[model samples]
Target: MTNTALTALREPAFPDAVITEAIRWTEQNGPLDDAQALRLAASRTADAHEGITQRALLLGERIGLQPELARARQWAPWVLLGLAALIVIAGLGLAGNVVGGGERHINVIVALASLLGLHALTLLMWLLGLLLPLGSVNTASLGWIWLSLTARVAGGKRGQAPVLVRAATGLLSRAKLLPWAFGLVSHGIWSLSFTVVLAAMLFALAFRSYTLSWETTILDPEFFVRAVQALGWAPAKLGFPVPDAATVMAATPATPGAAGQRTWALWLTGCIAVYGLLPRLLLVLLSAAVLRSRRKALQPEWQEPYYRKLAARFTALAPASIVDADPGRLRGAMPASLPASQLHDTLFVIGFELPPDMPWPPAGLPAEFAAHAQRIDGSAPARRALLDQLAQARPRTVMVVCHAVSSPDRGTERFLREVLMHCGECRLWLAGAPDAGATQRWLDWLRDTGLERITASDRPDIAP
Candidate 1:
């Protein structure tokens, strides 16, 4: 693969133009069958957009849509983090208030439940999801909303973009890359927010003191005891202390000692830290790993029906005749020596579709060169008639004139090839001032056609 094609698959910029260029190349290089060309073209445009080179409109790098998407969403991460921080701060405030003053007993049930119960419930649900598939449960998740939100605001809907960009924009359910990126970012914020919540909880505990006890209007002591015991089981295994059966039985709407309060606080915070903050942090890392793996797997697939049809259509064109002086290779082709014009009977100068504004037998034509040269249109019909004429006129040296400004297309390439076959001696002459971009395209066509040299004299006014 050329660097440009690899880039086309990688960056994903303006791809339509690149496909057009690849198609054109396949048309001219007939040895490369349509399927091969189409596969190359499809692979390049499958996921990325390609940019055009400024001067020659040649294929350039694949512009990455993700970077552009990120740039568009630059403020999103900080904004999401800010919102998460505020929510965590608010949750800490609500969870921190010790509901005891006169008796110095923080309602033990509320105190632990406020800090750890929701997180434990969430962890239980997560475990349940793993153990048993819950069909059609509409769990509330901020991740989904945030991922789609990033897609919408990131120009994921740019006009006529490839499947990947469309997926990033959420037009397809199977967008592989964009969602991963959003997931990585969103999970990171969730992890950070949970960490801050844990920090706030610990900070509050440091400055304040409250005793722990539980009060129940309906439930028996056994029910509360079993609930606390079950919630503490996992943390207990990791060495956190659980209140004893005696403490549970004696627990009432009354204050306890500072040591008791500290134990209860540590047990609650330990559960939240282990089951909530830590698990969310792990999810953040997992999402990041998934995103990285997906990035490595990013590649263009060419097996679709759409690409197959294009390949068939392109291969259907009849190929033109070509000659092979077959040079050693692309680099530094050795130009063959053109014998002097005086050695030929007739020096025919053929004008190949020169623009009306540009005069024929353009100025700066050497007196020795122009005197023996005669002009003729370089079109197919004109060449066909000229072939019969040439069969009889039998010009010894036919110098075909083409502007250095115009890119070499099939018509001109075939004309020169046919003329070279029929004439005793022939050479392609590029007429006009040299421009690097046009000259390069022209020379590439010449090399492909097995014709490698251009004459010295050129008329400089034409542009293609």
Candidate 2:
């Protein structure tokens, strides 16, 4: 079994998208055929839910559902990496345009806006998308694009690849993990872009000399001074120099002194670090933390009608092996029926379908009878195992104990008839405080099956 199958059967830690895709594949493919279904059912574990999950996974593996899902998963990270590379290139281009070109004149205000303006807008939009309850946020992300590209690259029309992609997005959206997941990728790319921008700016400043001054026709000089001081305050606190009023007033289209230019260059890089890169980096961490915390809740909807129906089918398949055709009576000669008045020396008592709360080998039974009794839950494997034991022992008399609360059915009748083939005489005992009608119902069922010699009672003693 693959890690996915193991995790799915053990807990909901299985990938939600894959779980949904696996289920979708099952839905599209229909139930497993009887032979395969019964084979899985026969090996059911103690936990019924786990048993069903195990069977579903086995069925998927047999029909090639799992391999298709695995193939799609293999291409996801590569698609994401390709998308990240594109974002990095776009970032470098934007920063190069702002700081590049061998020009003697560089506008300080224009440089800052060009570097950080779009980042601020997109960041605000991401925040708004998160606060609002809408699906729009999902599409506005690199993660969504990555998912689409992965599906397309893996052949979306082939097998269950498209279903896998849709399931992944749908589950993430419903679980509220979409925003954080998208934000994580988005902020990470933005951070990378800003890093590239800052690096380019620092490199250009170190290698090339340019005059740094603000240019405006409508805005007053005082406005520019306040703006430079205000923008520089946070960066200045962190040791980036802020140009004072004298430096700000001395501006022109011509190149400035080396000292003035140094102050302006540090100020530009500092603003980008504080306003652009730092916020995005922090958001990247925040998104990662949120996604990590909420990951467990991203499970398949087990209570959905489709899954519930599958659960019923799987449960039925679990104990279905018992319904097989009865092994013919005693190989050759039929056993002679012992009279009701006769008490055999060798007795075997079998408890079948008894309630969990019911006492085994009832309290008043003789020690000899109690010693020979064994209780079994109605599983096909258990029933077959017990039959094998009885065939070997070949006890002269066999009494099958049952809970009176359970109505007699064809399954019960077939199993009882098979038991009669192994022993000379067979008896039935419905143990519980059943009403008169319930007892009479069993009596009718017993007679109808042609096992009329076997009498049933609530009593524990075997006095016939």
Candidate 3:
């Protein structure tokens, strides 16, 4: 075929080897005359081009671009963490006001802070659950807890909850979920529990009071009494039935006296517990939740299926002759009639008979066959010498067949690929399937590497 016409029929995505093989076949077998061969090659090229184009279109339709929105959903955890931080900051400001004078301001601040902090912590726990090792204390216990809560809150199907839990656990075991799952579970448990405890303690301290006693006072009784009076507590002398200093302090800690000072210490302790412990817990949870959600969303669903399909499809298309190669012996015993014409053409077929009880050698039959066939047991070194000879001789084709031999090995395949690459004019056809998938895979490998002229015979007989 004219190169221009053949080029027009080529599919852009089809590997170059397929096109090369089609062209070679058409040139050799299409017709008796040059004109007819050219015409036939053009038609075959068109058919091949159409087949590849259709396959490409089908692949595109089956697998569309992954949705961007799904990607964003996976990253939602980061946003939640930011919001949690904002809530904690506002809570701190409100806490300051409450401690200064307004009880209402302080109460509002603490409540908001606790709520935000808890959510953030939960998020962190969820993220941790996605990462880390499965069956570890953190992965097994904490991962289960957060996922269970997530399942409940999300209203995921009851059946699915168990499946998701199992998947989450597997994520840890298989190293699929990773550091994300571990983070989520760890943060969630620690933050939630801490927040609840802190809130309870703070509520108790805000509404209660305490008292103190002194061993002696050098100042006049009225001095102490006036001090208590300023704090809105009525102080009485020790000589008469007096309002207990402890009770007065409890009633009004803000009063300007020793009792009020004691109240301030208790309040300060409560504030420190809430601000320091609560915010840290919230940050952990929120970070965890965000990470877990994002990891789940970003995970590629097509990864396993795609590779599985590729392997299966390649196996299915494997040349039949190779699959049927006998395990006990090479194809039928060597044919009796050795064609001299075949040998003269630089492309030939030779067959040999072997003893039935032959014990297979460790290096394989090909090494031994080389010695018997050519009077030279061209192992690796000899094989390389043959490739060098072939590159210089530049024969059109070479076909060798050895009986009672196992399939070719990596050395044989590598030799063939090198020969094909070096001697562009020569075509090599390797027949005999010693392994189920080995030959086709090697052929594909050659094709991928641009050695398209090499072909494997699928036919049952050799009549040449």
Candidate 4:
């Protein structure tokens, strides 16, 4: 078989023994038939595909890559842009009024009202994004809650129900998207409602100028007649009316044309204000309703005590105490009672007693315990036996100090997995140097096997 094929067969999904037998069978037969080769390739491919698919599924569920939530992310930007447009229009109106020369500049009340309306509209869009299920979006909706409830009910039942329920519950419980969705909808609704009310107030203010009017020069017929008479007289004497005369005529009382122009301007301004506020008002109201419904559906209850009890029970499985050891203390603190054989058993920690031959550190030892130690590779059968003995001597929780190996092999991962399987109910914490990439891969493997990595860090408190 090609190296690639050989590598594929070596994956954990395929039994090593089975691959070895197949290879041996092929080699001894020498020049297999086409059918035989095809069978071998197919078997390897099946194993590889299964492994990849299983890993992908576990990872996806862990990260809450639900269909609904994915859709939400896609449309979030568009909603934000709509909100921005409302603000831009309101700002332009305010700027235009501020810059234009008039007896009254832009009404501060109207400008403020328009701004409030825009804010309301923006709020509404945010709410819609949160509450309405975007089609095909991978959202962690009520599905997670149902799965968790089912798990609790079926946990101890016979057959596949318990297993299936537990699997579903774990996926839903760990996923973050559901909680995030709740928070977003809650906050968005509140914000949008406030904005909507503000927009309405602003719209009312923008219409105030149109609703209330006062007499002006433009509204006076006498000013119009006199102004026109002067213009007619001026055209004969000069090409343009004199500056002083023009100023006097311009200030003359309003005519029907001037009154009509003023009325139109007032009406247009009022329309602009109302039009700008309406969409935002609608959006805000829609968002508020969605938020209210979601809140009702997801009302929080009192469950703290129950969760605390569960946490306490889980932590009870850990061993009572462990000796604190760091990289420097490895060699001297090796436990003496450990047997040299069986170190290869994997997941065994050999703790050595401080030997007289070992050198002491410059600082004096503390009153709490005897000398410190280091971790040794327990993969060797002899070393594993020694470590196993020490583990048995102490309470299962006794921490062993060990020297950090320069290059711990991949077998360490196998050993950790074996330890977890053997202990079953016991929680395992592995302390080691910083190596985020390797740690993540090991953790992912553990997760796939229905186990969790309690902690993996280089901090002194966590160091073994």
Please give the CA lDDT of all the candidate structures. Answer: 0.50, 0.68, 0.36, 0.33
Clashes of 4: 53
Give per-candidate clash totals.
10, 0, 40, 53
Clashing pairs in 1: 11-63, 11-64, 12-48, 12-49, 13-49, 13-63, 14-50, 15-50, 432-459, 433-460
Off by over 4 Å in 1: 1-70, 96-105, 111-140, 151-166, 169-186, 255-259, 299-301, 310-464
TM-score of each: 0.47, 0.62, 0.30, 0.21
Q: What is the TM-score of candidate 4?
A: 0.21
The best candidate by lDDT is 2
Off by over 4 Å in 2: 1-12, 25-44, 62-65, 156-159, 254-259, 319-464
In model 4, which runs have C-alpha deviations exceeding 4 angstroms?
1-65, 68-464
Clashing pairs in 2: none
lDDT of 1 at 460: 31
Score residue 194 of candidate 2 by CA lDDT. Answer: 81
Please report how far candidate 2 places residue 395 from its true position, in Å.
Answer: 49
**Candidate 4 Cα deviation (angstroms), residue 391:** 21
Give me the runs in candidate 3 sitting further than 4 Å from their true place. 1-134, 139-142, 148-163, 172-179, 182-200, 211-279, 282-286, 289-310, 314-364, 367-464
Ranking by lDDT: 2, 1, 3, 4
Tens-digit lDDT string for candidate 3 (1-464): 11211122123322222222222233233322323332333334333234332332333223321121122223334433443354445554444344444332123224434434554555555445444332443544433444455444443343223333343344334434344444443444444444544455456545744222221236554544444334222111211123345533343324424434344334333343444454545545554554444443322221232222222222222222332223443322211121233222343222212223433221222332233233124244455345445434443444433321344443344334434432223323333446646556555544443444555443213223
